[model samples]
Target: MSLSVMILEKEGGLAQTEFLEPSRKGYCLSCLDAVKTLQETGRFGEAQNELEDALRESENWREMAVACLLLGELFNKWGAASPSYTIAIMEKGAIYANRAVQLWQIARDEKLFEENPEDMDHLSSALYWKALNLASVAGLGGCERWTVLEALQAATEAAEQMSAMEDKKHSASEVKARRDFVEGIIVFCRAKALEGNHVSPTDFSDCYHQDTKDEVNFLRHQCLELFISAQEILSAGKQTMCDQNIKATTMIAVTYRLLGEREKAISWSEKEVQGRLQLHGEWNPRTQLAKRNLSMLKGITDEDEIEEDCCKLFSFESARSIKSEEITWSLDPFKLSSTWRMNCLLKIFLLTGVVKEFQIEEDKLIKFLQKVRKSYHDENPFHNWYHAWSVTHCAFMLMKETAIGKILGMKEKLAVLIACLTHDLSHPGVNSDFLIKSASPIALQFPFSNVLEQMHWDEARSLFEEGRETNFLSHVQEELRAEILEMVHQGILATDMQIHKQIVNSLSNRRDSLADFEEDDMTLLSDKAMTVYDATSPADRLELFKAVVHCADLSGQVMEAPVAYSFGRAVLEEFHQQAQREKMENLQESAFMKNLHE
Candidate 1:
């Protein structure tokens, strides 16, 4: 009986030893360590392989959690290479992250005891990874209210879980650092939710425990604070290393601007500019923004002064007409102003070689001018004619510059001249918005304001077609017709300011590209094209053109201060008359009257 009992005890002891052997546990640990090392070294493929090996060896919830977390991170990194893949990768990442969370819960429930800091760190790391994945998924899912609400809930829960873990007694510093990191992320998620137009905070009422407005404001403040803190930390070391701080400052300024706190926005913007300028120089992008904003702010007050200065710069005077031509239109015996006719003649002479320079054929020029003057006597305004003429004069002066003159072909030069001459030939004496709002017959015929510009081109073409061909087209060829037409069309379209800035920016980039080309290979034609392009560009030329014409259109305004004041007074009276008409008709008050009062 004693021998049988000894045999049973020996066998049971052997079985227990085998089950609890250190070597078997060490092997499992080594597998986990190797997988982590691979992941740390960024050998994602190798890390995946090792993780699979570790999982096969352990088949436990802890190892499974680590593997899923690593897989999610790897995929997330890959997705960042392209925005188009963000949604796909984020979806997959969310799946793995959720899997990691589930596995971690299982491991926690099992209550496996481990003395090493690595075990606790792994759980914290899993939570951090899960939060990041959830946040990414939220970002990629876009602004759908329901979808964002769901994502915000998930991210909030993950953040809370992380915070709770950090509060534990045995939490590692690394774990606490991760908790802090995720706090910023939570703030970012909340800010994104508020800022996005589609995802209203009210959509998540069931999950949202706080007041929507208060929550949004709190999140915005939290985001700003975190950004400021990060910037402070980054810039704490050296004065020379403040790039990150400058960027953060700009972001804060932009946020303030979005929030409608203009004063704070401006203050922060000034700081960014001043800081960068002190660190670098005036040419820096930040400094440029500051200067531009300052200029814009000053412009409101300086516009009248600037307009006066521009008028003095481009002084216009009536030229002596060769013949005292009395032209009659529908509006009585209108003696055509000889000085005005002479000014038009001078413009033609400067712009085209249609007549000899020293031996100017005053007769031909005067005849042409008189005909155009008579044809549009009722339709054209003095300001519109002068504006077109001034722009043409500038274009002519620009053409005389060595760089522009050498490259522009005869055809292109003529197109520019003709474009300048006819640009505002058929102008109506009101702004586009006024015309559109009033449903003026011209505006009704062409629904698009841009088409009004096109009409000018068509009128010019009709004039040429009606056996009124000018000297500029003498060398024109049938083959070059398409190109000329395109140039003219572009030039007319350029007079519209709405799309001017974009076109100018494009041309500027092209000019920069051309600057890199060798001098011998440089084509001034391209440069001339850009010059014409800039001159003809809508907003490009309109703002300047409007000011020029407004002054010239009202040139009678500055004939003397009293004359100018009377003109201004007359304009005010006309506005008051319009307001009275509107009131009687029960129509909305016109913007013209509003401006007059303001």
Candidate 2:
């Protein structure tokens, strides 16, 4: 998707094109050449000023849309160059592209497309550029998840329209290439949204989540193919398709870097840098960005090295000497570092006989625990690894010391404890309300009800899947694996505070039935689900398990006053931060958060 300035001839210069007035043809050609030169030479401001002036002087909607599209392209390049202004600049580009789309839509509605069939191309191109701009904004973060979905929708619509065009004006190969290019960008944007960060692609410090790593890499490979195909198809039409070719090249470089093909990434990046230098000069922001990317690639190494180094930092000591009493809520998990928290969790797992009974390999279990610990972002004051450790520790205590512990089978108990450990996995610190209000990426992908809980359950399930190196349950009996995972899912979802009352009430309704069971009749709490118990139904048992985990999730409230106060304050501070972001974004702030801030 590019500026509608030229129709390529044999030499790739401007040809007789649609939307040009015969009387003003010479003037238009001369002006377009001058503007293209200004753009290529990196005189973006001058070119933009000129285009704005031209826009104001436009005699028709067609000219206006063209001017807006050009401005959007310029802003995209400008945003690429300036890191700090990327969001704002890309947003501005989206606005301009949207305006162009509107103008074209107006023109088409006025029967312009029917009268001049070639105008449909203009409309499709506007939509394509609009999609690209919005995708760029979404990929940069701060925008709502709806914006990303909208970009994808727009791109799809554009591609459909391009494919339906029967006009010979656009080459068949070029049309297909442009459509592929748009699809590649859509895939790339999806990958970035999945990453849940606005950080540069080169910054591998926080990469994909352990579970989503495969899916993200799959998308990367798919996009890389799309980009490579687009670049190859446009190779012969470089002069006419300069913008799209360079964009494909840029994406190819980025995709390779993300795919961990460092040398190929560097190779593609070097080509992009040289291409930009030749086309736009050394001072061009696009050229500068390419140069920076190339330099970063040369300096940095594989991200796996970071993972390896992290593994070296912590060792799992044998848990034979660790006491069960140390897993109680009286112990402050917040006081320990993430590594110590991991070690503590491992010891508890061992002490509880979960590892031994489940036939969990210690090394694989440690690896899984490390990944889970790392999944919790430390930047979140309330929902960090500390919170996960604390909640898990509380669950461990309940499973060992409480009446509910006595009622659960080993599979159910293990499920409840594991669920608690991972109940807040990959939490972004913001509450469900905030995620819903912002329409954040996770919010969009997940159902609105207990969105974060669903995400946690999904991630937890992924961690224990077959063939995963970190899967502690990989060698477990298929039947046992299914039972534990199902319980884990329910336990995790039950931790959603929104349904807290429902879960408690459900458990309350079963209390009479539960009390009637004798110690000998408590075989339902063990592995014999086939044995009919008089007092408890399977549903009642599940509800009890739900309530148990839910209680563990809220155990921070029952902690000693000082520890409880710290937790409360941490959550409040996190709420305040989310509220501030809402205010900055001009979104509706949470009422409680507003009250807290005031």
Candidate 3:
């Protein structure tokens, strides 16, 4: 037997391993089948319940291992959805992964190998994934946790398993090589995970001796040593040093920086930044993070500047004139001081002329709009319906102020205004990041991606499909309705700052693509007129629509000092509440706290 097999047999495999007696396997299999179906449908919360039930009913370790591993993966998916509670969610996944290893061990101890020797392979795979989970994220809570060291031990043993696997009989040349590669990977993973933990903020409040300079320096040296070993092994076969190349290099930079080797740190970190940009492109979060780090190192900073909201209140007689066909709506006369809901709808009416142009049934659409307004939680500090109104107001202003020839078609314009109005629909006084990190049911429903925005899109679509009354687009052509629906999705997704660079670049690229139309179309219109009601490329038009909505979403940040600062304070209050929650649990606080403190 190979070393891994021998090790398993020696552990406790002498006993009979058929603990389940084969009769209960059918029920476990059916439960697993149900889990698979639920997972496929993105019903993660439901799938988790089924898997936990199977675990309770499992008669043996093999069945337990399967359940544990699947549960671990689902927990990870759930964590990804928890944008704010990611730390807690990921920790839960790690717990499940670690438990799976224990279950696999129990199977070996029972000598289940006599029935299916292939169980060893499952054990090996489980160990590797467990190590990966340990290394994937930080923010583990509790006072006496052994995080990095524990992860390193798991990874080291996993690598040993791979090394033993290579010597098994009939292990083809390719199989042996693959094992060799993965062994190297596990080693690098150990090194990278160590580096990750090394940088994790610790309680350095004099109460902890390990938080001192000497201890910190020693930890850095240990991390540097591991990265050097990883760099040599993983880079030996290729010039590119594909796996962990940037990670190792970045760690080296971080180590040097910690040691006060400024020049060396800058040199290595610049290389890491370049590699990240090349691999992930300019718009990726990793690329942005690296760029931000580089800028900090270079001592470059950008200060925020907020312009005034420019909303001025007008008397009823004067504001009423804006609705006349003869009078034009100008930003100067509009005020968002009071009557925000009325002004919000009035702005949209002014922009789209839906009632005048399309001749919509007034009571039908107005009542539905009221429902949409009421849906927003009035208690939200910043993301309430009022905030949504402000965003819509900004979008309307952008459409009107920009040259008509440069504006999007009527349908696109309407979609942007509508999107801004409902972008925060059903906002629970919490951000997407918060919901995602908490692994709330909503996050599970949208699992592993775009947690909040996807839910918002779902809400918006739901309202649209509520009935012809709320279907606001029922009067529009079928093709236009579909376009409007898609625009809503794109517009909402574009507001995600994680991909802000991509959205900006996409819009900037379109400026050039549509420039010819802008000039040619402008010549066909009057000097004072603006807007190109028709566009050549519908796909390109959506990009512009997204840009408009994104700008409006960020409008609060650009408002005049009083308004902008007020909104900033509102956001900060929400974050303070989140921080309070973290402190109560002794969990790692939001990174935004550091920014706020700074």
Candidate 4:
């Protein structure tokens, strides 16, 4: 299935041999190094040489795709460097940008995004640059209509591309913030074009003749609206960059001036000038430019007034805080039977130094758990939030009793814990068999597969992403989290018994391996590592995680008689209902329905 329905959601430098056996990644990195210096200094000519080399003998389509986009961007950057527009450079930039867009389109047509979704981001970047190249044309001449509209369209497509990156590599806010940035830039271009078109004639310019007073009035209003929208997005996107705000202020000043609002123009220009002067200092070139603009607006002959740039970049000391002191975790979910008992389990997980070992923030973990707890279908007799807590509790007890925490490394333990906690999340109070038999749409996506388990994991993943945005696992490194999550995914899926033979065989091998191994004290590994611990292979650890969670999920069968029977009765009741539902709806009854009376 397309992932849309799914809750979708560096190393620098290179050695020589790394290039000899060049992968797409190696080629891309080499190309990146070539252009990396361009951002600082150096001639565009040198950067083009490296880019051409990468493109000349490219074996990887994705690498070629990246090279084309980067080549386009390189030319664009070069074109934008000159104060006066150079027709040759501008035309070359536009041509490359268009080619980049075409190559990306061809890739999509070839199902490259489907074949390897990571290519989507690169394709998106290619689309955005096309818009950027067109937008830089000042929206003038006979091509103005096409240039302006095409730029807007391409930028919107770029934003769509940004939103498509929900593979857990980025937070939702990070994606939205990026989309907002593109929206801001595209809108700013429109506003800039309009403002420029209506400006008073310069010695060699004829733009004023192109616009009548009424046209100018209408265009200025449109410019103001677009500028405001751009400012709001830029302010909210990632607010640390003070430069965005200054850029917006400059636009506001220019637009107001074109509208014949001299006082308002001067007012906004002064803010920009003052901000630039304070931020960059009086001697800075940017500050000098701002001063000249302000001087023209204010009709001043005197020295410029300097103001303090009180604006600051974002810095959070809490991001680096370490919890060295031990915490006493005392919550016993069995004794404390509140439906909200899951909250305590989460807290205990954190306070017991487990989270410290994982480098996950306590508050984010708590909030994430609470979100899952609240999302449960509590109305269900079984397979509800309380049952979720019970399974997790049983898992916790099993881990403690077996000293599994010691035997299975932290990643395995974590995978087992999280898998147990979220295993049955969002259950519909019906078994997967019934859903499939009834021909439900939910089953259609995973026909003959673990539909319910897949759905539960999908829901859990959605909730997990929400928590991630709030920095729940912000303390955890990305690679480590990905590793743990892989195990967790296996553990959750292992709970499904439809493919019992395969799971049993896999677990038995790992179980025997672990059984002969001597158990030791909990030896914590680095929180940042994604590697396997001790002598165990990653396959063994993942298998162990799945085996342990499977045991926890079925632990209710071995509980006290009363507790075990209660669960048995609940399952039977749900089965009986499903049977009756099948009869009423004229559907095939599942195996559980045959034994409902028993």
Assess each prediction's global lDDT (C-alpha) against the native.
Answer: 0.50, 0.67, 0.56, 0.56
Which lDDT value does model 3 have at 209?
A: 32
Please give the RMSD to the true structure for each candidate, in Å: 28.6, 13.5, 23.8, 23.0
Could you arrange the candidates by TM-score from highest to lowest?
2, 3, 4, 1
- List the pairs of residues colliding in candidate 2: 409-525
Candidate 3, TM-score vs. the true structure?
0.45
On residues 1-598, what C-alpha lDDT tens digit does candidate 4 reach at each position? 1111110100011221111123543454456655544333333355456556766777766666666675665555444433223334445555566676677678778776673544555555666566556555434311433454455455556556545645354445444544554555554455455544522323113333444434445545665765555566556665423554666677778777756577888898888888776555676555666776576455323321221121011012221232322111233333554523534465446533567687766545654565566557867766777567768767766565443555577777777777887888778777887776654545533433588877667655544431132235555654576677667777788889775677667644433444333344221222111222332666555655676788778766667766777777777776787777778898777754666676
Q: How does residue 324 of candidate 3 score in lDDT? A: 40
Off by over 4 Å in 4: 1-336, 347-352, 437-441, 444-448, 466-471, 510-535
* lDDT digits (tens) for residues 1-598 of candidate 3: 0111111122222121311122333435545564445534434456556656777887767677766665555455444333334455556566777787788776667676543435555565566555545544432321123455555455566556645643333234433433444344343333333333443324322222343344445555665666655555555545333424665677667667656666777787788788776665666545566776665444322421121121233122233555543222322112344444454465456546655564455544554465566667867777776577778767776666564325477777777877887787787765666665654556545554667787777777755541323555657654467677888888888787788898777644544454455644433223332232235667656766787788788887777666777778878876776767667756566777534544
- Ranked by TM-score, the better of candidates 2 and 3 is 2
Off by more than 4 A, model 2: 1-317, 512-537
Q: How displaced is residue 175 in candidate 3, in Å?
A: 54
Best by lDDT: 2
lDDT comparing candidate 1 with the true structure = 0.50
Better of 2 and 4 by lDDT: 2
Against the true structure, what is each candidate's TM-score? 0.33, 0.49, 0.45, 0.45
The clash numbers for all candidates, in the given order, read: 10, 1, 17, 1
lDDT of 1 by residue, 249-354 (tens): 6656655654546567667777777776775467643356555543322222253355444322221233323222321111111232435434644544544553
- Model 4 lDDT, residue 159, Cα: 52
**Higher lDDT: candidate 1 or 2?**
2
